[model samples]
Target chain A: MKCRKLKDSLSAYISEELSERQMSRMSRHLATCSACAGELASFKRLYERIDAVPQVLPSDDFEERFWRKVKDADAGSSSVKALPLFDWTLGFKWGVSVAVAVVVMVGAYFYLHTSYGDKARGKSEIAEMADIDRYLEFYKNYEVIKKMDFLIKLEKDKSLGDNNLPENRTL
Target chain B: MRYDRDTQLMLAFKRGDKKSFDILFKRYSVLLINYIYRFLGSRHKAEELAQEVLLKIYLAKDTYRPKAKFSTWVYRIATNACLNELRRHEYHHHSVSLDASGEENPVNRKVWMDDQAFTPEQSMEKRGFEEAFKEALKTLPERQKAAFLLNRFQNASYSEVAGALSCSVASVKSLIHRATVGLKDKLKDYII
Candidate 1:
């Protein structure tokens, strides 16, 4: 491999990502090359130095303070949720309105069904009217003659009505 | 079982389990805070950013896909949080090195296989070297610094680095290389 290629491959080498074959070729190049070898060594040393740098602990109460800030931020966001409860009330009002509508429908059904219902009304009315007409016709045909006979008898009696007239009666 | 436990834990959090969320926060907070601290060189900012990352996990638990390792996913979130926080503060505009010299820096105590192996003079010399070395680390570009720290300190792969930075693997490689080259140049005088 060329020096440029080996230089670029140093990162992958440190990371152990290069395949065995590629590693071998790069090793061979490094063996023969002075500048690349020095460069690789320095890179390795730098990696080691960075690793050797002591890990620092966070300050006392750092985590606690951090969580406090997070809580504040979260609380800030949740406060935004407060305004939408008004919209929730609107939704509840809609639910109450629907319930009222259902109650009104149920009340109307019973009121209209029993008080003004058309149950057996037509048959009874027709039967009563037919009976009245039949009675009238019967009276016109037979009873009228019988009544006329009685009226004639009464008229004959009326000829003697002057004799049958009570006192203080006008004939 | 581990993956199941984690996924179950996340699902529980999704169902409004604050205890599950607290468990997750406590579980990954140190590593994530360390990752951010290394990136931005500020423990205070790192801790703050770590909390933000946890909060995001809390909010985004519903959409989290468990196809990859949970650590990978959380690291992705942590790194992004650190980056966003750093950007908001514009910390990159002025480089801040976290290292310090001598006994004044609490973290600078030397590791000793044997305490008698080093004299006070030798320890002082080493401390000076370490301080200068840290000074050199500040010379790298901000992206390079982030790439280097995430790759070396976190053992992040190029693909993972790319994932964290929203860049391609090739670009991640270039960033690492440039970072290494910059460090190498700064430390060339002391290399054996």
Candidate 2:
């Protein structure tokens, strides 16, 4: 009704966004008010100038160039998909796995080197004691072992097909 | 479900009909280029973005549903692309040097102001009008500019603009209203 409200609606009025009731009301107001009519006229001029701005067309190769880009994109995406080796995510995964493995390995090495060394030394001492016991047992029966060694060597010569050797002479 | 012709064409492409896509392309290419050109004020960028929109529609064949009009979907994509570009740079100004080389330059746009039919005086007037129009266009916020361009130049309805902008029709009404008023205030000097 008032010019302020009507002024706000002018844009919608010119563009036909208003409902029919609003349109008729505004139409009636415009007919009575020269000031509103002048404002409407200038807004119309704005529309005309906006509409007059022309379009610029793409070049002749537009479609062709677009198709080419599509083809290149298709190629690029396919190649990336096909090769897991070329995938950055895959590389990242492998890198994380290797880092985790290295961490575990270093952790294991430190754990073994520090806390397990005494256990390993204890084991080696037992092994050394067994060796000593084995040598001591042979020395305890030194004469009998020497005699058994001669007999064992004769048995070995017999099994070696050395029939002509003195040890292999059964008679 | 009933679909618009373009949506049907897209569905047909989804069904492995490449010719349907060709039809859609032929239908939208020029219309889209003009819309983008008007939105971005750059011929080269408009052409580039139009191609991208087509490519997106092509790629979306399998995923597209008849949720909205094909035109609405298209304008949405085009709008998003234009907004991204505008947001990337604040678009400090749009200057056209008539002496500059053709389409490669953003400001070196080809316009009908250079029509041979116009007398030199008329051409000069048209030139001034276009310059003021461009400057006025840059002054509006990006969303207002988008709504104005779609509603004014693209012949989109308030509902259609709302669909494209992902806003309500009431918002579109307000946006377009503010845009028109803003442009009028800024261009008052040159229009008369």
Which prediction has the highest lDDT against the true structure?
2
TM-score of chain A of 2: 0.48
The C-alpha RMSD of each candidate to the native structure, in angstroms, is 17.3, 14.8
Give every collision pair in model 2: none
Name the regions of candidate 2 deviating beyond 4 angstroms: A80-171, B90-126
Q: Write candidate 1's Cα lDDT for B72-168 as tens digits.
A: 6777677566546655665444322222112223233222122244343453466554544454554445466667777887777888777666667
**Tens-digit lDDT string for candidate 2 (B63-134):** 878789888999989888876666455453443221222324444332222223343244346677776666
| Candidate 1 per-residue lDDT over residues A2-75, each given as its tens digit | 79878988977877767899889889988999998987888887667666767666677866876777788778
DockQ of 2: 0.48
As a whole number from 0 to 100, the lDDT of residue B37 in candidate 2 is 78
